[model samples]
Target chain A: MTAMQEGAHVPSVEESDEPKMRDVFSDVPTDTGLATDPAGVVIAELGDADPRILTLSADVGVTLAEFRSRHPERYIEMGIAETNSISVAAGLAASGFVPYVFSMSAFGVLKTAEQLRTGAAYNRLPVRLVGRLTGLAMGFFGTSHHAVEDVAVARAITGLSVVAPADAQSVISLMRATVDREGPVYIRIAEDAQPVYAEPPTYRPGELLRVREGADVTLVGHGMGVGLALRAAARLAEEGVQAEVLDAAWLKPFDAEGVVASARSTGAILTIEDHDVVGGLASMVAEAVGRAGVAAALGSIALPDERLEVGVPAQLYERYGLTVPNVAAQAKALLGR
Target chain B: MRVDTAPPATTPAPSDGDDGGPTLDRGRSITPVELARRADWIRLQTIELIDRAGLGHYSSTFSSAEVFATLYYRTLRLRPSDPAWPDRDRFLLGKGHAATGLWPVLADLGFFPTEWLDTFGTAGTALNDHPDMLRAPGIDFSSGSLGQNLSVGTGIALAGRLQERDYRTFVLTGDGELQEGQVWEAVMAASHYRLGNLVAVVDANGFSGSGPTSDAMGIEPLAARFESFGWAVREIDGHDPEALLSAFDTLPDPSAEQPVCVIARTRKGKGVRMMEEAPQAWHLGHLGPDLRRQVVEEISGRMP
Candidate 1:
């Protein structure tokens, strides 16, 4: 926990009962009672499980420093050519082995999108693309590093599954489900978010999960948005407003059934994500709810359609409506509080 | 309009013509005359398939007919019976506009039924404008966009080392396709990995979809460029299977730890008289019955 040691020196923002409350977003995340690793190191489970699995890196494999040392035989250091790396990953997949192509979200998903669409998804090769520093995770790396359009771009490709995980446990769970799954997949991983699950949980894309239960309103979340929703749910409870928080669970093969049911159960819903509202989970859920005609008042908190700024993670999350209080306020407004 | 009505001044594989045309230099399973005849046949089928489809890459296919003839018939090590043989050498046509020329070659070798060619370019047909390994049996990788094949070839070469398979990978690329930056990335990777098992054959047909390769975006000193990138380079007349085979012989040994690139300099259109003459018009054009008959007669007359 890098945050705890230096956190005392910097005057805290809204000091909490919890020890070492640093809003600077350092190595240690605010714990969410979930048994999650801070390093986002669960992908090594994929390396350990399948002998045919290989790790393809476009100069960003350094992110998987632990996996490389553990599975030295299965690592391929690719050049900075993102498009070429995708094609090469597809070639490896075509040769009867699964290759997890890794790069920063901006580089992996946005830059190499065409090659992935043509080479992997169109061809239905089982090439897993693990995009790191998704959303605004790379705040200090500038707007180019932020992958705001990753989910939207990945969803358009046929036979490509887009999975955005909230934390390390969700990553492991998603990997467990997709390890033997056929076809191409893009995993937009959150580097380090607060631990939410009590233990590591496995998931199926069709099976939606409810993090916290309430009947007054539904706070729908995708990826790290779920962590904010959970925190918002706790805050709203103190205000005598019960909010039900839900994780999108799956992005591409979305849980329309669960989404419609949640909207119906609570006449008010607010969808939130660290991506653009235009094509991200918020848009998908809104469309589904509208088509189902659930009669629920739907609102969304998402990134503006523009380049984001570089700063500490907390400051960027604050500028965007991607924090607990922001979620709580949006939920209250959606419910006419 | 007619660039060159006489025979192409250069051939990929040079020949010592005694009096008439190319004579067999190697007493082999596929003689030079036989190779020339097969190339001619492939060209005829290329026009026939494209004519049936009402539109296709005529010049692109005609330019590399000998390339298909040489690799499948002479240079490549393939088990026609076992199309999915893991140990088989892989061939990918990066300039996949030339795929119509390859369909007949794969069918000739029994990779699929010849009747499959009939449904080509149809609504539900497997054969589209580019090659798909899923639908077609012998195509090693699916390719449509240029600049990707080199990377795929490099991965396949590296996969051979990982999977412990002793299979060599060959890629056929358009000269103009080199303008793509990804091709250079693959070139750099091939050299970095020292993938001696990989061989890239450039179909220097001198014309992209728009016009002459030089006019579109000149990527000249092609051989010198590859040499600078640490690839073992060789330049040859692309229309000659004899030359392609000879160049194939000089490829770096698999254990030599140096990748080889053979630049097969070729005409935009080698077999058909009209396509060879017209630089820009026939890159993509329908072959009318009258023109088809005339081109067929010319190719038939030139059958060596």
Candidate 2:
């Protein structure tokens, strides 16, 4: 955490010329696949679109620098308390202002879960929670910084809309799409994510995008996992396996229709995400596919529910089998290859 | 008695002073005698409402009875007939368990029908132990949890400033509620934004849900604590309507851009002598019929 805060100069506690912690992942160029900072840019643009929209940063206004600079009056720096920030955002929402509370996923969903439930979700206020650097995207920041069950925590709340934009485009698109809703919305602003769409695709909630089409198996990915799923699909294509990829953008009002359709068409489903294997995209997809009465052989790939070894995201991806080759192999296994 | 749905007749507005500060609705039209009488009535109503529930926060409600009476009758600039009146001053209950005391005041002011009070803490009742803004129209904000409403109040106060609404937002919290870390978060924010329109009143009843607030998690040096947060702090006797009224009036001017916090010393189960000093969180539960009658008699006999 101190290392992340200090940014450039962080002294090593362990004595080594080649430090295992930093040196191993330093040259890997920590690829979070984010083309542009999402909330930092999109929310400011939304301010231009709707004057009633306000950006609230809970000690992380630095992430929302663009919005703060452009609309200084509308941006509220709420300090370190996420719970109070949510309620403040709720009050602002109830008073007819759309408050986009940009916070860390570690604090936003988990720390403020109760406040989010009572103030935003229960009241159904349009308090947009931008959970930046979700999951292991922050890399080596360890368990406290990692938000594994943000989806599970957020989506459990009745009215909260959980979204994970695959890349910069979807963050922009989803922001544009759900900005007008008079209910709570939680978006995981991830980094190290690659663009799945060629250009900014039109985002309609509950509609899943078919990033790739095939007849063999359906590769389900969400947020940063979309990149992993696409990589796996490409790997499968090289091995003569025609794998179709689907992006579950909106998690609460999940694209159940598209998931079931893909399951029925492909007859095999391999779901993956940069989250735990429980209560996230994998759980959501399994429920959708099962309730739809589809007999797709389902296999889910996700981080295990335990304290993960601290490493760069790329190393963690390989160790946790969250890479393209691993996902491709999972697809083959789902097909009984 | 049926609740009056009509707005109360406007009183002679408070005379301007040298300070030229904005005036709060302090017992306007209603005389001081009537204000004290109504505060007694609110205590009576809280007893009845909690009695009906079979289990409720009697001590908590009693603690804030006068604060409720003073604010609704005199301090808050409200339009109970139009609960959503845009410019009406807002009253938020951070100590939500004590909402029973506020229920009647809202009803009597025409925020809702008095009949709604009959359904408190019952199935299909809009009035729960904690009020909900969605269910009850006059509730400026809903609260079930502690430390939350003050933050919401901070937002409403910020709204008043941003929109130049001239309306004030008041949050009434229990002393125990200060134990919640979120409350301090809001206190800092209120000061940062210089939300002069926000007035926070703490009902320092000394007890929380489980025990004495000091015993539970001591946040002593309470006034200095708020002062450290950059709010203008005032210590008052919460049980006295006149004191409460004067405290409301002396709050920081909106032009000053500083929020105010009133630390009103109060007692849990205040009017009911037996429950007043009952040790440890005598904070909840209903008195059985026989004891309930005795408590009511004791409270009424003491009223002026």
Most DockQ-accurate candidate: 2
For candidate 1, report its TM-score.
Answer: 0.90
Q: For candidate 2, lDDT tens digit of each residue in A1-337? A: 0001112233344635422334211122223343337657778888988988898888886667778889998988887888888989988887778988988887789998898889888888899999887777665777777778898888788888988998877777888889877689999876667767655678677778888899999998888778788888888889999999888887878888889998999999888787877798888888988898878788888777777756666656666777677788778987988
- Any residue pairs clashing in model 2, and if so which? A32-A191, A32-A192, A32-A193, A33-A192, A33-A193, B25-B74, B27-B74
lDDT of 1 by residue, B1-304 (tens): 1111122212234243444333222222576677788888888888778877889888888888887887777667666556777777899889988899888777766678878988987888777779988888888998988899888888888888788787789999999999999999899988988889899989898988888888879899998899999999989998887787688756655666889998988888787777888956888888777787788888878765
What ranges in model 2 sit over 4 Å off?
A: A1-35, A291-293, B1-27, B279-282, B302-304
Would candidate 2 be rated incorrect, acceptable, medium or high by CAPRI criteria? medium
Candidate 1 ranges beyond 4 A from true positions: A1-40, B1-28
Q: Candidates' DockQ values? A: 0.59, 0.65
For model 2, residues B1-304, the per-residue Cα lDDT tens digits are 2212222233334443223233334436555555666766777787788778888888888778778777776667766556776777888999888888878777776668888888887899989899888999789888988889999998888877777788888999988889888899899899989888888999998888778889878888999999998988999998886777788766656667888889989988877778787934457776777886777677566555
